[model samples]
Target: MKKANLTKIILSISACVLIGFLSSFATRSSVDTWFLTLKKPFFNPPSWLFAPIWTILYILMGYSFSIIWNNKGQSRKSKEIIKNAMMLFGIQLALNAIWSILFFGLCNPFLALIEILLLWLMIFETIKAFKKVDVYASKLLIPYLVWVSFATILNGSIWFLNS
Candidate 1:
């Protein structure tokens, strides 16, 4: 790979890892305290599973984004498409962090459920947009979408059970 592309990949991955790291601040404190008190569903995975899973997901997300970012279109329309795809990626990324804040930091699963629905939509739209730019990039986000889908169900269940 060219130095430029490698740099973009590293930066993209670092940015995603950084976001995950920062988001953990909200989660770390509550996981042992507030989250433990909640009524989780039987299917809820062990608490220790989250960190590694999230780290992997974030890495995938960043690599996928780097694919889109490095895509240099030859036409005006292609450039526009890439721009919009990147914008969607950014929006969904922000929503990802916001969900963490709402659910863990504020200790509001109900609100988090609502925000996660939007987050899911953004991820879906982002996938669609990424597909237009790079099919592989879009494919890379599939696991993230699936995981968030499961998380949405989990969040709703927790809210229903606890409320």
Candidate 2:
């Protein structure tokens, strides 16, 4: 790849990692104190699994977004479509971070459940939009969507058990 393209990819990954890092602050503060005390569902994965899973997911998200960003749409309408798709991606990314703040920072799993539903929808919309520009990019997001689907269930269960 060209130097400029490589730079863009690096930046995109950095953006995703930065978001994850910031969100983790909220999580780290609570994991040992608040989170460990909660009554998690039977299906809840072991505590050790979350960090690595999220790390991989975030990397995938970054690569998927970079694919969309680097797509060469020729027409004005196509460019507009790409812009809209990217905007959706941004919204979902924000929601992802907000979830950690809501659940861990504020210690509110109920509110986090509601926010996660919105995040799931936004991710779905992002996938659809990405497919219009680049099928591969859209495919790349499927794991993220699936993971979020599972997480939504996990969040709901946590709320149900705790509340």
lDDT of 1 by residue, 132-155 (tens): 988888988999999999999999
Candidate 2 weakest lDDT stretch, 10 residues: 1-10
List TM-score per model, in order.
0.96, 0.96
lDDT for position 10 in model 2: 82
Best by TM-score: 1
Candidate 2: tens digits of C-alpha lDDT, residues 1-163? 2112676778888899899999999998899999999999889998899889888888888888888888767999999998999999999999999999999999999999999999999999999999998888888899999999999999999999999
Deviating ranges (above 4 Å) for candidate 1: 1-4
Q: Give per-model CA RMSD.
A: 1.8, 2.0
lDDT for 67 in candidate 1 is 90
Clashes of each: 0, 0
Q: Give the clashing residue pairs of candidate 1, or none.
A: none
Report the lDDT of model 1 for residue 85. 96
